[model samples]
Target: MPAIADRTDVYLERFNDALARFADEPTWLLERRKRAMERFLQLGVPSLKHEEYKYTDLSALADGQLLFATQLAGAEAALPSYAAGSSSDRATGAGPQVLGRIPRGARVQSLAEALRSQPDLVQRHLATIADCEDHALSAVNTAFFSDAVVITAERGAVLDEPIQLVFGDGPTGRLPRVLIVAGRNSAVQVVETYAGSGTYWRDAVTEIYAGQNARVDHYRAQVESLDAYHTGRLQASQERDSYVGSFSISFGAAVARNDIGTRLNGSGCECSLDGLYAVRGDQSVDHHTSIDHAMPHCNSHQLYKGVLDDRAKGVFNGKIFVRPDAQKTDAVQSNKNLLLSDESEVNTKPQLEIDANDVRCTHGATIGQLDSEAAFYLQSRGIGAGRARNLLTYAFAADALERIKFAPLREHFEALLLNRFASQES
Candidate 1:
């Protein structure tokens, strides 16, 4: 095992190459990029010794030589059309390839365009919500991300249609970024989908800001190739009387990690976090979430469920915090997992930290196999053993899926879940 300092030379070279392409950007942005790169160099890739990453290993990401997707030509061809036949506005790398009818009072554009046209707006909210200084992956993204998708809904605006951001695979490591801002009393839905083939890495960061009385529904679906590596982080901030719901559905990747963190900055705010992940074979998935109640009269709810088969591995860690000033805070969190095979493994931890004396917080975690009695009952009702097992597996995951309020998005995920189980039976 080499020292961590010895492993940063390759990333330093990549950062230098990235700076050359971003030379034409504004002085402020260029300076910020340089600072971020320096931060990454200071904090090399986390090793298994790191407490936060005890179960997952990222040695391949640190040691392997991967070309940045920005440097590769004709990489768009590798991206699959996951949103085919959908009536949603679409945006791809560096630009919006397919333009749909963007609702009135909403602005959607590429990060390059936003930086050039609305520099002040982009600068004010870009890295404000996400903590790039402390997290190494976020630092890498801030320093090396080629382009991003920026979505903004103005005050009192309501967008009934969803905004879809698609990231396709090419033969290169990719860093994708998304920023969404919802103004006071506004409402909007944003969906992010990742699909690709071949062996590569996708490191992504999404930041969302909801103003007073605003409503933002964010969804992410990761269906990359089984040979790929994926690491994603979602950071959200809510103001007084605001609402934000985040749903994550992951079914692909050789190894995947999903981190979600939200802060309730004002009173009378509500936050909901829900996720469902189904994995088979030797795939591994980890979900880590944190919800902070900084002000009084705030409420948060979290539920995460996983279905593992074969030799797949799953990890879930959820934490909720209530500050001393956060009186009248109400929080509830639960994690439940179902194992389809004896070889499958799960590690679950749910935590609650409350500094306030007048707060209600509860958390629990459960990991177990399917109910033998239930399976036998289904089998006795003329259903085959395999069919009965599949039905029970779907029922175990239905709770998290039902939390998705959008009809079309919910239906799409339902189909994906069914297809996944059907293929396993075949």
Candidate 2:
């Protein structure tokens, strides 16, 4: 891998050349890609100095010394001998409803496949959401995006299952761009997961369109090899009376960064975001989120929790912006961190920017160690210290798990989390 001293423009040129290789693509979209490529050249990797990225530094990842999966691995071979403890099973939920939001009529279009079937739609929304505007890496994705999942839920439709995007670890450096569109008055859930035993740098970007009166549940889970690096952006928008519930649970990757934002453009809209990150060993995870309230009578809530140990580090930066016309907006943001070891560290901040006078918004953050008293109480009940700590941490994360509207899926998630606790303790 070339050192950071190499000009970023070199990578930009490579990306441009790759884009030129796609001739069948639309001209407008190609121009858009070129523009983003220019932007990427101007802005390479983000550091802690960026306002939204002040807590996370992605330079080491930009250097790209890490390995990447070049092809999807064997399916049966990826299966675990037993459930729960195995890497593959841990990345999946019990039963079929694990990602219970894709409706029967909705189509699943993978970019690799979309090129032959739904080329227009793919070009329309591919780089549209996280566009190449903010970060240079996003431009890299826009310039050279290949595989993506495209889903469309008709208006007034209610899906009973979550759309699942299973990424077979190809060779390292895999960037998957996924797009989802929910019609007006429709309700759906979509879950994007990263699993497999491959050591790869995973780059993902998702844009979800929640039409007027539509409701959506979005979940992004990362449970991959410890040698991997993950970074992604989730951008969503709401129409009049639309609703969105988004949760991101990350338990993998040596270095992972998540940047997600939702914009409420409709009156009477409700949006909620919940995130849970568990890091151990020398891993570092950072999550940054923003809820933009642009209309009146909108309500938004964000809650994030992190558990770190063994020199692991976690960072959370949540911001809620209520526009001037967004009076009557109700927004709340909170971030809680648990440090299991003296060497573990966490940086958390909850920010609220309110321009409306008649709005009710609050933000708070907390970072602390385990409750010694609670551990002792469990020990007094005959439970071992390790088990007691695991139980407490499980309880701490239970609320977030409970937010899942489906019962079977929720139970599966709980089991997954509990299994992690048990393994860490053991």
Candidate 3:
């Protein structure tokens, strides 16, 4: 890896070289890209000393030489078969592809198209919710992203079918961007699937804007190559009486880091964040989430669980903040981890910072191996030892899986969990 000081210059050079590709873009977007590039340079690449990234290292990403993907190659193969009939909008490393029918009351288009057709709407929401000043990776994404998938749910529009987005990695690396805007009283669900091969890196950022009384459900599944590196950020802003549910599952990549943040910007808003990560061998996964109760009468709940085995490592740090003016705020956060091997390790921290006097908030974390008694009981029922352990692990993960209201996505994850554990049986 290059020295910490050189990393900034490397990325800066790349950013400068990438400006040629955006020459045809509008002046405002060009300016935004420049500003994001500056911020990325200012923050530089994070090291172990950085408090927010202390648990996850980015050296591998910084050391690699990856060029920005500029072509659409092999994206068709990356699209999932299950999403065939779903809203036909898919995004590959090159950009968004419109092949299938879109549900009513929703507009799904590529970011480039949206910028041209709905400049006002795209400008109003893009880069407004996610903070780039403090997040170097997000800044990098904002600066280098070639194209994005934009999904807009019109006012009072109820989308019956979920929007499926597939993002494939590029030859070297890719920066994937997604923006979701749910208008007043609108309801929609979005499912994002990331798949790629080789040792490429995927840096992704997703922003969700939920208008008054709107409901947005988001599901993200990352199943990249085992030798790849992935870092993603999900940020949501909720207006009055809006509801936002976010679920994330990670099962691939050598090193993966996920950051999720939600801001309750209006009263009576409710936010729920749930995540599950299962890793084996030398893989590592880290998740950091923050929920800000900026308004009174807002509620937030978070539950994140991890399963680690065979020297794998996992980290979960969740924080909930209730501002001084957020009276009657209610928030709960929990992080749990199950280690399937003696060599596996996990670090969990759940924190609550409440300034409001009349608010209710609670946070807790747990890290432990599978219950020996539970495994023993299952084995005594004529089940093999390996099968008993696998069953216990599945049961521990079922809670979060069951919370997924989308039946198809939930079933997909369940199958992944079963196959993941069963394949490793002794």
Candidate 4:
């Protein structure tokens, strides 16, 4: 963790290394990488002075304590093993499985593999959704990503099982990317899991494209180590009458920030964004989201909740935009926080910008402590105060948890939440 006085050289070296290693890639991809690198260098690291980053600062990241591995060794054995099947599989040594719970009809490939195999498809939609020119972190990922997970569903295909992607990293840090493409009228569910130990950084980005009338259920569960630093961005582009539901659940990292953006590009499209975050100790978690209605007759809904204990801090900022051409748009946004300790704190801001008079838009935020009356009611029913408090907290989180459609994934998160509550009580 040597502090480099000139961080620009370190980043430039990494960018150059990536270009050299991937020199055989398509010309279009190489040009894209060059553009991303130029934008990243120009944008640099965002400080608290930036309005979008006013609540979170990247001074520590810019100080060069993070290491980016130039050469990867023993990569196969370092892969992550998932908890497939039932909760019983969570036991030690369950063996590593690829494409866990993936249906037979669905296609999955690694970025390197996809570039060599499905170059046309990869080139068509690699950097379409993410706004790399305006976002520095996304630009950095676009320039330095070593590999990615690519999943695609063909036209009219329906997957019966959920697709799971488990990612792990060593101390050198990792930059992983993902692209999900669903064809016309297809439907599928995806679960992305992030877990690691020790002090490292995980910078991840995901781009999703939904064809006409397609449906996608996307979920991200982040459980990084308490000493780690994580920042991620998810961008989605949806077509006519398509539907996309995203669930972002976080319970890890000393400093974690997530940026989610979705554009309803066609008429009759629908998007739903839901998130739940529980943090304790000195952990800090921030979530910023934007939903854009670019066409007429589109709908979007967003709900995010946080439960903070000990000295943890949380931030939630959500915005919805309806363009002038996007008449008959309906959008809603809400952020709620519950504080279990006087030392804990939260900052929430919800905004709506509507350019169309025919649109229906609303946004609001709420931050408060537990209800004493409810606690008293549970105490009168012969329940201990501690147990009653746990019940109330779980109930608050359930509003967002129950939105998960996958049974196994939902059950797994429920168990983790229960264990977290138990630990906090003890």
Candidate 1 ranges beyond 4 A from true positions = 67-82, 86-100, 170-173, 423-426
At residue 79, candidate 3 shows an lDDT of: 41
C-alpha lDDT of all candidate models, in order = 0.81, 0.73, 0.82, 0.80
**Model 3 misses residue 366 by how many Å?**
1.0
Clash number by candidate, in order = 1, 18, 0, 0
Q: How would the candidate models be sorted by lDDT, starting from the highest?
A: 3, 1, 4, 2
lDDT of 2 by residue, 1-426 (tens): 244437564565566567756676668767877887778666767767777666566666554444221343433223221122223222221111123333465656544455566676566566676767876667777776654566778767788766665554543226677778888888888876666564556777789888899999988777766866788788898888998899898888788988888889889999989988888999999888989999999988888888888999998988889899999999988888888899999988777788889999888888888899999999898887778887777788787777766554466666655666565353
Q: Model 3 over residues 1-426: C-alpha lDDT tens digits?
A: 346658667777877888998888888778888888898777776777888788777876663364342232444434444544444435433564333346788888777778877899888888878879888888889998888888999999998767777666443237888899999999989888777766667889999999999999998888877877789999999999999999998988898999999999999999999999999999999999999999999988888889999999998888888898999998988888998899999988877788889988888888888889988898787887777777778889999998788787788777666766565465
Give the TM-score ranking, best first: 3, 1, 4, 2
Identify the leading candidate in terms of lDDT.
3
lDDT of 1 by residue, 1-426 (tens): 456667777778877877889887888777878888899888777777877788877777774354343232334433333365443545434532332457998888777777877788888888778877877878888888877788889999998877776666433227778899999999988877777666777888999999999999988878877877888999999999999999988888888988898999999999999998888999999988989999999999999989898999998989888999999999989889998899999998886788999988888888889899998999898877666777787788888889987676777767665655564452
Please identify model 4 stretches exceeding 4 Å from their true place.
1-5, 69-99, 170-173, 423-426
Model 2 RMSD, rounded to 1 decimal: 4.7
lDDT (Cα, 0-100) at 328 in candidate 3: 98
After TM-score superposition, the amount by which residue 390's alpha carbon in candidate 3 deviates from its true location, in angstroms, is: 1.6
Clashes of 1: 1
Evaluation by lDDT, superior candidate among 3 and 4? 3
Root-mean-square deviation of every model: 2.7, 4.7, 2.8, 4.3
